[model samples]
Target chain A: MSKGVAITGMGIISAIGNNVAENYQSLIDGKKGITRVEKIDTIHKDVIMVGEIDITNEAFEKKLGLAKDNNYSRTAFLGAVAAKQAIADAGITNINKYKTGLISATSVGGMDRTETHYYNYLTEAEPRKYIDGHHAGDSSQKIAEQLGIEKSLVTTISTACSSAANAIMFGARLIKSGQLDRVVVGGTDCMSKFTINGFKTLMILSDTYNTPFDENRKGLNLGEAAAFLVLESDAVVKAENKTVLAYVKGYANANDAHHQTASSDHGDGATLAMEKALKVAGLEPKDIDYINAHGTATGNNDLSEGRAIIRVFGDNVPDFSSTKAYTGHTLAAAGGIEAVYSVLALQNNIIYPNLNFKTQMKEFNITPQLTLKEKHLDVIMSNSFGFGGNCSTVIFSKEA
Target chain B: MKKVYINSVCAITPQKTFDNTQFLEELIEYDANVINVVNPVYKDFIPPAAARRMAKGIKMGVVASKLALKESGLENVDAIITGTGMGCVRDSEKFVSAIIDNDEQFLTPTAFIQSTHNTVGGQIALELGCKGYNFTYVHSGISFESALLDAKMQLELDEAKAILVGGVDELGDHTVAIHKLVNHIKSENINSNALLESKTQGCVFGEGAGFFVLKNEKQESSYAEVVALNTYNTLDEESVNEEAIRFLEENNIEASSIDAIILGNNGDVNFDGYYNKLTSKTFKDIQQIYYKHISGEFNTASSFGLWLGARIIKSQILPEAVKLNITETSKFKTILLYNQYRGKNHSFTILKQC
Candidate 1:
């Protein structure tokens, strides 16, 4: 049997907090990060709330010690900050010591700058630096450079909200196949007029705080953040004597093949992803103690993911909840954010509360965990479904 | 370990490249800043009802993938992976402009749904009804290389026997306008034959889709063997040569062993130096080739380079239009394709004759 990949360290910077410790504290203290928008000068600032990080672009630039002329986008800056923290937490001072690769996921790479300087490029020569950084891979490239990774397998995945989860899944596969000794896998996304307006056009942006698994649920609140994890091969873990936080036991990616954006009426993709993950981990549904659902509180996602959960676990459903209400929907960063939450759940044996839940979903009898509960958790499953009908499930366990 | 071989290849680029039997017999000359692909009869491959909702990128991707699968003589594969830099830009622009124009009210889900980066892969799966592993990578120029790496890993690990992989992108109005504003697109137009000599600034922006069917077992239609693929997010022009050498060395081959090298030259005065350094230095004596002059430049244009490489290896003939130097090999045994976009997302792919 194949041993699980070891998650030696993790780091995250979101609307809630700057690091893992702070994020965990915020979750325990029941602090929801949703608030009025302050970063982007959007016309809908008064109409829609967001989980915007309080840090300014100047602050991020200062934190990275970059020159003023450097063209690091806000998305790349947040990604570099979070990825650096993850590398430090993993105690990996020399990134090239082993065959290491970096897989960073982001839906918005440098659009914040592009949108800001959209019309300035022709007249102003100074803003031309950002033009080269507008592609989705530019953010990942910046983070890789900051981490001192060169001439290695550095790539980016953008599958909407499931991008980071797929990055983690690919990182684990690389390690398991002996292609890389160590890998940094996660995702980062900064708020942009592109996404904010995009979601608004879909009519999925809730004006108020989202309520997941509730009959009166409206939609999701957009958010911005970055999260990363250091996944190491078993050989590296044994050699370094690393403190294994949790094992990436299993991961599966399945497509709905139903519609471009909408989930299938029966949630076929979600069910397949969960089933495949359980099989890969050599575990049963009953063994899972908690589930970090992809409940964006949007009408489509909640109902589809809820039905998938019910179908996979049958009557023995675990204590599942969505922390999206706290952090809002971070798009590509959603998977990484929840991944950190899952690892923390295993470490603390505490299931996070699914904030702002008043009633059960009308479509099914499934109900999310509303209040934080202390329990001896061994295995936790996390789900992330995205546009393009992409569905992914990742299982994190205490033991490999 | 299962050895994955490329069974078939299909490409829809600015040049007449869709028909694998012909090699750039006719090319579309564009004087404008933006270059659109020489479109095929997409209706023949996709139904009108289903094609109505697809963006140009999705349509190109779906048709290219279907053509590739049909050429490979396979009904479906166990997995599908795709790469795109600017994914469904038309829809993205539509959604963004609608939100701005309509004051963020009265919006629908079609454009927003199609704007996701993985729409191409998801659409292919939906059309084939193949519920298997699917993934989409959207890293700049390395996007397609990332997909290739993923497909290679799965094939070697025995996870799947057959897989479909492709890279696609389409030009959007706002994106092109912003890119022009930033001078990422060429300011002065140049002839396709003189792109290298008239290197002024910025690349000639174009869009296309290229697809390939890879299987563990080699068949009669197999074109080439995927030896190795590697990508670098950032590599200085000074280090590209060393990196390429190291990649080949690690694969138990040498630069001299490569029968031909396909270079991605987009006429960008600032970044084309990277490719020039290669063609003028260690690769000077080797049979050299280039394609961006005809295909134009886009994020996934390297997939066109890969298509050219695979065809060269299979057909064992170098098209005169693609030849960069007079030195020619009698037999095309091994081919190396190097691609980069504006000095980012550098990738090296090596294909061997099966």
Candidate 2:
């Protein structure tokens, strides 16, 4: 309990880029990944934009060298790709060395396959392999198998958009509790007609670009992505002489219980989560130098989260921005992807801009950091909220 | 750290165990490949207006949780956590099929909102108006175990006094069809009695919800103490015995001291060996119990085993139906529960009489 969890490595594949380095470059260059759907055969491609990855499922499968009979779903494919990268980035060739575990998160697990063959499963036997990958946990199990992580705590968390953050939180707790020496924590989610229409029904899908905390914001652009962080216990780090990338200083998850999809006007849950995270880190809000706001750009999230931020920081809020404009709302993968971005911000001492923000939100006098700026950052606070009133906050610090 | 205890448990399985007042005295003999829970009058626990919008998983979870809380004599918990592998599948299927059918047009928010994997936890929070630590784990067979672990940690850390935790999954046409195609669900109907010997590729698929109120302090309602729980992503059949021993040893217990062992024998021939390795060899002398035959099988079905273990500790009675062999013990003080699905996500849970 005394030794803190160390994040030794991180990997990410988002609409903005394919790897951590590419994503960092894209962020520094202010490149956004917003575009209309080109790969999936959806009629809403023209009306709804997405943060879709450039690679196709076939190419992704090729990267993993899967046999034709392999029942890897798109979600599993994305997850394996990112998880392997994280493992490699950690410089650990033998993943099974330490008492390692993998904790992945996903809201849509092999759902793309399920949706594609929903009606045709009876008529088509070719896609039958995908039938077993339909559960929310299947993709994670696949990722673990792909990583050769056997006989470990391989699991998934599907707390909607905040899922990946919760996964990271749980992984940190596991490491802290001495349950596992090292754990790969992150989330993966591929674009699906299910989530696209699901968000559309809520009237929260932005047609063009998302403007977080804007006066007249439309909504978010859903994205497909996978990101993972390799968190190792202090003893493992000491034994392996691991290169520490950053530290998962604190994390907290709280429920609003106000509404299923809506947050309270005052952001009660968000406030409690942020406050608890700060308490966990034994740091005050003033210690945070940067904040990666959840900023889904939805009418509900931005307002609720903004109020929560204001409540925590008061007059001297830290330099903050929402990177969601770069990679639309990745739902379950948001927390993991943002975690990568948070670590990157800490390493590079740069605050990524909140792309597409034009005006200050009227509900509260809070304006986001619109330009990428060079600043010395010590701790970065990231927030993620989801349906079912799930809210989570994780703080990444340069020093433990 | 204070010991975590299972204050009360309420299960909505294929059997009638919702009230916490009865055991499996009368079981519903279902002849279908998929078994649905013997539902209680949900209106007695949840409002119809609220119940109408909930998916079966959410409704069952909420109702079962309310029953557990009521039985435990608590109005609200410090936190609410739930585990579901598919999570609101009816709503997920509805939303997905609607998107494909309408070309992503005319979609309503109801199905979409309920489609999240954590909808049950969120809905429970809303119903109880409990603004506290909330989490939902969707980790397949370990989903319930993950929730239990989280609750245990919170109780040990004194962050929460009482936490409402549960594992729930519901039946849906698309899920069933897909599972059947993948052979995770039995392709053909098999007798429950012959489940373990059917030499089948898949187990009997079922839907159920099991909820428990875990408290840091022991009380009159407390059934048993959660001594320890451990989960593994993948374990060879050869390691089951060692793993069980190591788990008990870590908890400062011995294999011989375990009063009874509850195994998750879902009857999937391909995976049931993980249990057979222990029940048939390592703990051969310990009284063995199983429930999937009666509850059917689901990802979170292990929670039903926990519910049963708690009940056995409290009532000190093992229904003749759940017994694996004619072995009895004078006192039921400690129970060990081991569960896995398709030979992955193995878990060992130890519960002790309060």
Candidate 3:
């Protein structure tokens, strides 16, 4: 069998926690982060609850030591912080010692800044500095600059909600194919009036705490976050004698080719992605110890994803759950944050309960894990489905 | 590594290249910095309902993908990968400006739904019902090359048999006005034919979609084989020559093996030096060509360069309109392409006659 890509370190800054430790603590303690909007002034404040990070731009700038004249958007600032923490956790003293690359994903990019200066650009000059930072690559470039990973392959992926999953898959392949010895793979997205209103237009913003796999689930709550994981090849791991957190055993990306915003009735894309991922890992349906589902608590996602899970696992479905109730749907960063959670579950021999899964779905007989369960686990599968029928699955294992 | 072949290409640029019968036979001239794509009959390809809510970028991507698939004689592909710098910017601008313009009330979701960077790629997959690997790259100039690299790697590994890879970007109203303010767009009107000669500080902005079907095996329509691909997030001016040498060397091909060089010269005086560095130093005697003057410059405009490379190899005829120098070549094979945007995201891709 082929050796799997080894995950050395992981870092994340989501609404639930500022780093991996806080996130793990919250998960074990069942401390939810969903709340009413506090930072951004929006009229829908009454109707929407978000997994908003309780940090201000000024505070972030001060922490990152960003110059006042710096044009770092909320997205870039968060990404740099998470990426830097990942490097430190990995104990990588010389970033350029090995062939290194960074593949950062983002859906919001610099919209946090662009929307603020959109109209002002036509009349004001001070706001014009952000004009160049509006593209999706800008945030990735800033993160790359912050990490000092220059003259290497650095790119950004924006496949809606599954963007970070694809980034991890790409980084794993890069190491597997000997394109690079080590890589930093993750995603970053910050809440913006643009996305808030965008989700509002779709009418998918949940009014209260999200309930996943429930019959009366209303919609998803939008969240903002950034997460990163350092993936190193076996050669690099052996040379550095690094401690491996987990192994990315298998990964796959398949489009539903179904609808633009809605999933297919049976979750064809999700089924294909999971089936293919199992095949890549040389495992069967019975091998997945737990599943971190992409249950956004939306009406369509839960039903479709539930149906897909049933289609794949038939009578004996694994102990599956979604952490979206804890952090809302972080869009592009969902896969990254969840990957960290999956690894934590493996390391700690625990399964964080899928919070807020009260009632069973009417369509499917499968039920998600509703209580915190302590079971020795060997493998976990993470599923992330986004708009455009994009479905991706990554399997993590404690063994190499 | 297994070889990947470019089986089919469809481009909807400012030129009249959409029709297979003509290959830039008549160059369309434009005197404005911001030029829109030569419109395709969207109704012919899309339905009324889908086309009604579709943004210009989505329309171009769907039509271009359809045309490429049709020409390749494939009903559906195993994967759909697309690249766009600012996806559906017109919708982004509309949705954003409306948020401010309307005080964020009573705004519908159509514009916002279509504003994502992956909208074009997602819509293409939905149209064909291709439930395979789908990805979208949104890096500025190398966006197209990133898509190409991903497709090429998959083909080499036999991950997917046939894949549809494309680059699509559309012009937005407010985006154009703001770019003008930043001097990213040229100030004075310059004819498309005289783009490079103007020696302007900024490029002539343009928008279009280019799609190609790549396969692991060669077919009757196979024009060129993907030889090598390389991208750099940053490449200083002096190291460009060494970089080109190392890229060709890694592929075990010498500079003399390069029959023609496809240059992405958008007439930007400052960054064109990267291209000029090669022309004056190593590839001076080789046949050189450029296409941004005709296709106009966009983030993924390098796709147009790939389209032109395939056509040159298959037709064995170079249109005089895109020729940079008078040096003639006896044969056309092993074409090298180099592209950069304002001295960032440099890419080098090579193609060989199949």
Candidate 4:
């Protein structure tokens, strides 16, 4: 693979854990964060399972050291916390030393606040502070402010589930084009009644644990999370002597163009994305060491993605698994958190088990990794497909 | 580096710009704080089955994209990128209200599905069956510029030959009411032509969509070449000009070379000074033009500014209505467009006549 953008650091806060180390420990211990929703008040709370973080909005605000009158939404707070952790992990003392940028992805934005005060904003005065925070970019703006990144190219992408993956891709392109020396790219999304009810209408929220690559798989559990990675150029990495976590070797995005919300029956978009990613990385399917599948466990996604994987790898499929059972489907942050997991996989040479799988999928002969296994993993490919038929595949390698 | 060309441009704004041949010859004047697009009979481009489910934003975006594709004479593009400030606000409003009013019961998936910010980009891709790179940006005022920058980079890198880029935002009743409460919408109605003179604190909020086919290789229909584009998330009064001049310098162009300037003057007295700074100093001698009075101010209103720049360069005519300054230039080679929202998310785009 070409000398790719170096991922100097990564940080994540999800239902499974609040930090990278905790998340890795959860993965090895086979601990799932799926449980009944405790934070949001929704009618479907009893019928659905979710990967909700145990922290409250007040706690997140306190953690970020923001004033009580601050307009930091749950999404922004989560994004700021994760981004700060990433900068620290990269061991950067000064943010303005280099031409740095921030690319954040979030579908929810401040909708958590919006939904809570939807009607109250019209009648009450206290909740009116969130009126300006309703858009998808507000959270991104807050993230940039928290990172102390001003006069920079800070933007947000809202491609639903694959948002963070696209953010990472855009950041990588910026680095390749010499637009910026360092970039903080990732996605953040907080669970909201808007999304909970929206997905409830789609009838895709599982009542029990999600089972990926299983014949009896029902649907997915909604999740809330924020994950960010600090990508620095080779010159910056060498100059700063940053400890590289992994390298973004290849990335590609393709539209399914088959459905507004569902993937193609044949996973044509997913296949094309993977193919283009491999071509971009100048690697073949055999070069892949692990596949972090976008297996939402939804009947449509798993089936379509499975067929697409088969078409890409044919008979020599890599050990693949989906961590959704542990963290649920974190909408836009799915790709970002999955990327952290992919890096961890490459760093530790360990494959995480796909929990809740009891039966083999009849549509394809391939199955997910069922147990935690230590193996030599040099390259990992992570997939993230979202609403709007946005499909993305990002490859992470141990060596740049 | 490959030069990216604006091969074709189309817009469905408050004015009669949808018909490319008519260069805003007759403006549809409006006297309202919340203006809407002069509706295009979407049935001409979209079937009833599809149009029935679409919100105004989706319909405008789809039809505008179809017109762009028709003008470019291309069956499909290598990529489709869209930018929307509010996504499908009508649908979002509907879905959100449904959850509250109906107690989160009996809600269907149509509105929620269409509420995603990327719905327009995805719909265009589905229509063209263009499964190449698809991206959606939703960063307030610079949303459209972000998409343009992304497409320009891809074309510059020869990663894609032709890319469909668009920006769309539809006003929602609830959203409008809320904005009015926040003083984001003007309190009093005023003539469209008198927007800048209104001395209002808020803008005449509007909704519209603009789409263009950008290609790496210049074609017969190419309007102008995209020279350079940059966006800043935050900029104070002290650094706005420095950043803009620095951006121009990086493009190896001097301020004197710019023949015409397009400024996003949305009539918000507080923020309009950002443009005035350039008008009073940096670009005092150049021909100045603006179209927010005609297009109305939306998050992606700058897309209309882009469309205006392309039209001015291609036709080499400064429309009397859009002219902000009396000075005239013999050449309309390079047009610089700058836009920002509430003094944030600033974008500067330079387009040269090809």
List CA RMSD, all candidates: 1.9, 1.6, 1.2, 0.9
Q: Which has the better TM-score: candidate 1, or candidate 4? A: 4
For model 3 chain A, where is the 10-residue window of minimal lDDT? A355-364
Residues A1-400 of candidate 3: C-alpha lDDT, one tens digit per residue: 5567999988999998999999999999999999999988888999999999999999999999889989889999889989999999999989989989899999999998888989899999998889889999999888888888877888999999999999999899989888899999999999999999999989888899998888889899999999999999999999999999999999999988888888999999999999999998889999899999999999999989989999999998999999999999999999999999999999999998888777778787888898899999999999999988889999999997
Please state the error at residue B232 of candidate 3 in Å: 1.0
Docking class of 2: medium
The C-alpha local distance difference test score for the whole of candidate 2 amounts to 0.89
lDDT of 3 by residue, B230-272 (tens): 8888889899988999999998999998999999999888788
Minimal lDDT window, size 10, model 4 chain A: A1-10
**TM-score top scorer:** 4
lDDT, model 1: 0.89
Please give, for residues A1-400, the per-residue lDDT of candidate 4 as tens digits: 4668999988899998999999999999999999998999998888999999999988988888889899888999889999999999999888989999999999998888888888888898887889999999999999888888988899999999999999999999999999899999999999999998888889998999999889999899999999999999999999988889999999999999999999989999999999999998989999998999999999999999999999999999999999999999999999999999999999999999999999998888999999999999998999999988999999999988
- Give DockQ for candidates 1 onward, in order: 0.66, 0.79, 0.82, 0.86
Candidate 2: where are CA atoms >4 Å away? A1-4
Model 4 segments more than 4 A misplaced? none
Better of 2 and 3 by TM-score: 3
Tell me the deviation in Å of residue A90 in model 2: 1.3
| Per-prediction TM-score | 0.96, 0.98, 0.98, 0.99
Model 4 per-residue lDDT tens digits across residues B244-276: 788899999999999989999989988998998
- The sequence of per-residue lDDT tens digits that candidate 2 reaches over residues A56-170 is 9889878999887888878898899999999999999988888888889999888898888888887788878777788888898888888888877888888889999999999
Candidate 2 lDDT by residue in tens digits, B233-346: 888899899989988888899788899999999888888888889988868988999999888899899999999999999999998888887775768999999998888888
True contacts kept of each: 0.81, 0.87, 0.77, 0.81
